[model samples]
Target chain A: MSSTAGSTLTHQETDLHLQGVINRPYQVVVWNDPVNLMSYVAWVFRSYFGHSKEKARELMLQVHHRGKAVVSSGAREKMERHVTAMHNYGLQATLEEAE
Target chain B: MARAFRATTRGYKADLESHERRLLSQLCADVITMLETRGKQLTGDDAPAGTDAEDDYAHFRRELAGLGDQIDGSDAAGGLAPPDDAALARLLPDASSDPQEAAQFRRLSESSLRESKLADLRAARMALEGEPVSLTEEQAPVFGRALNDVRLTLASRLGVEDEADAEQIHQMAKAGSAATTEALMAELYAFSTWLQETLFSAMLDVMPEDD
Candidate 1:
């Protein structure tokens, strides 16, 4: 229950909301691979995710050095489609629950 | 589209040759190092980070994708370097669709055509050994086409069409011109590396969450 001092969430309402509400976030995770080039990875992010070249490259670098990066968070189905498309394009990619 | 034959030919064998493969792998390692360095540059620079490296990487990927698209387009256009459809037919397990069948036919035709080139090489070797064998008129064309195919395949893959240029580069490299070949090899290696990275990044952006 996200109730605070200034917020008027009545006790009855808070109890009712707490009964059964779960927020499940899906995360798009890119994995490091030996085959792909870093620049190419960045380009892909730009093209597919509509990320600006700079943002895409930054994400690519993070994935390159860090070995992985969560590029997006949203619905599970959307993430699945994205993963499949990446695989089709010859990239090693996957999805996971957002931490 | 109707199938048309060009005076040109190409093969994947050369593209995936042992030496080429080895060179490509080495190039990939170098690219990784470059990526790491670029990343460091981004992190170390306090001034508007992220843009420079990212832009460069995107351009690199676009170059690779452009190369791929060029080759595929050539195949469609039935240019002089149209792939050997006949060889593909022989290799394909099944040709379910018309397009698939067409590709196979092109591959097979090229292979059958290249057999004569192999024979010519053998003949040349025999001549060097002081053994002579006469060839029929038909046999002569086979050798010519086979060699032509090899040349075109290399040309198209490299996004070039000038046979003269290809031969010149080939000769220079064979003659131990290290600097020139090194530069060319570096480029090809970068291309392959970029291709791999582009696919990886694209997949990461689009893949769904696991259960």
Candidate 2:
């Protein structure tokens, strides 16, 4: 039951193309750092991102084996917020335009 | 001997000796001082500011006066640069690979990040005040973060740039000699690594697997 209340043009397609220059999704990438513990990283991914234990472990491993991993992706502002949150958790994270 | 953090009926507990507690609390206070100094630096004052025993009006006046000048600047784009000190830089890293963008992002977010980290460290000091370090479920994560910050500071001083560097530090700690300051840092780093490992492992044990 989508709300269709306030349109002079009724029954219009709400799904317009938003993936242009302005709406390109941004991602928060967490980098592997020697100071942060593996267990701590997994916990941060779980509690902060609400990832399942397995999923969080998987992402933590990716950051461990690979140089980094994109833990989240969304609007630029949201990704920026996530990057700040990751920084607050003492994890090295950078915000980038999602490919 | 410091007992590893373990899940208990109430929340989480670690049995630390008095000296250990004192050491951790002092470290927390040191980090708090570092962050407060950093905050003042970010607000564009090299001299430590705003800890007067005067009246509230004086404080408010200082606040507006300090902020007023900064806001009046024409371009907010040229923001505060990251700290030159390796420990401070590691604690608050760049949010972007691009230098300009990273500076801008640091300008926008570093203050609040510093505040939150300081808050965690203060809470950790309070937690350390007890006979046995006990944490409520809510407090555990905050304590964990403060412990991690201490480790990060030690790691920076130990020059732990990569896995190889970390291995050297581990070996140094395993040698069990604090003859030099570097060896002492390694010992503290290893101790923090063990404590944090136990903490998160206990925490993860309680969290739902949902596999």
Candidate 3:
């Protein structure tokens, strides 16, 4: 018998796996920075996310004390948009593969 | 013949204390309407020159739409929650604090409430005064000091800090890197619109309406 396990032949199967991998969820993370004020960070959250002042302040404090916070998480495209917004707002924001 | 005398009564109309409270409530509403737009401009992705009274307004609506998102995203955004009835009972103003100043702070805290009306109020007020104001939220203590300087200058010159002049509130944003010209302009426009509400609210508290 031919070594079927060693030889990959199903193109459709490979494509399916690739698609699934590409569709995996991504995370949007806002890192704590020295420059932006805690209040400003809260404002960004309030301004960008429509958060209440108390909620925004709590998140800001979380980021301030926690070193970083995952401000959002979702589809890669959505995470990318969030990251771009954070950048626009001058936050040290980033996106990465969610573990 | 004489008209029958009737006691006209609306519980609190003539009460100086209630009028002061009313003044604060009105001012709070006005400031929220005006400054909310400027606060929006601070982080808008659009180009600056594109904004005007109308466009800033439309964008303000869009930005405020994200208010829920902001609140959901950060606990801090909500700030102090409204006091529960029990908590509120214990929250009477201290005898030492000036009622007017307390009114101003209440207006400031409520500044995010009704945005569009506030924006209109701002535009009208600015046209009447022929100047502008800066409504940007303070950053660092130093920036607050700078804002005070700008605020003092504006009060002396035109009676309010004008965000239209970016040079004045230059370093108010302590964190963020240098923004592109377009980004900076957009921020400036937003902030100026924000100023309209803030100053108007403060003014309303102090500026009694003409009879």
Which candidate leads the pack in DockQ?
2
Once fitted onto the true fold, the runs of candidate 2 whose alpha carbons sit more than 4 angstroms away are A1-19, B48-76
**Mind listing the fnat for each candidate?**
0.05, 0.89, 0.00
Q: Residues B1-113, candidate 1, lDDT per residue (tens digit)?
A: 11111221221111233444444334333323333333333234332555658545644553454422132222333421222222211211121123433333333333332
For candidate 1, lDDT tens digit of each residue in A48-76?
77887677778988887888877877775
TM-score of each: 0.31, 0.85, 0.31
User: Which residue window of length 10 is worst by lDDT in model 1 chain B?
Assistant: B4-13
Model 2 earns a TM-score of 0.85
In order of lDDT, best first, we have 2, 1, 3
DockQ, each predicted model: 0.03, 0.75, 0.01
Residues B1-211 of candidate 2 have per-residue lDDT tens digits of: 8899999988899999998899888988888988887776555455334543332343344345442213212124555566656899999999999866887788788889998999999999999999789999999999999999999998998889999999999999999998998998898889888989999999999987664
Error of 2 at A75 (Å): 1.1
Lowest lDDT block of 10, candidate 3 chain B: B87-96
lDDT at residue A11 of model 2 (Cα atoms): 38
Chain A TM-score by candidate, in order? 0.75, 0.81, 0.72
Candidates sorted on TM-score, descending: 2, 1, 3
**Candidate 3 lDDT for residue B210:** 29
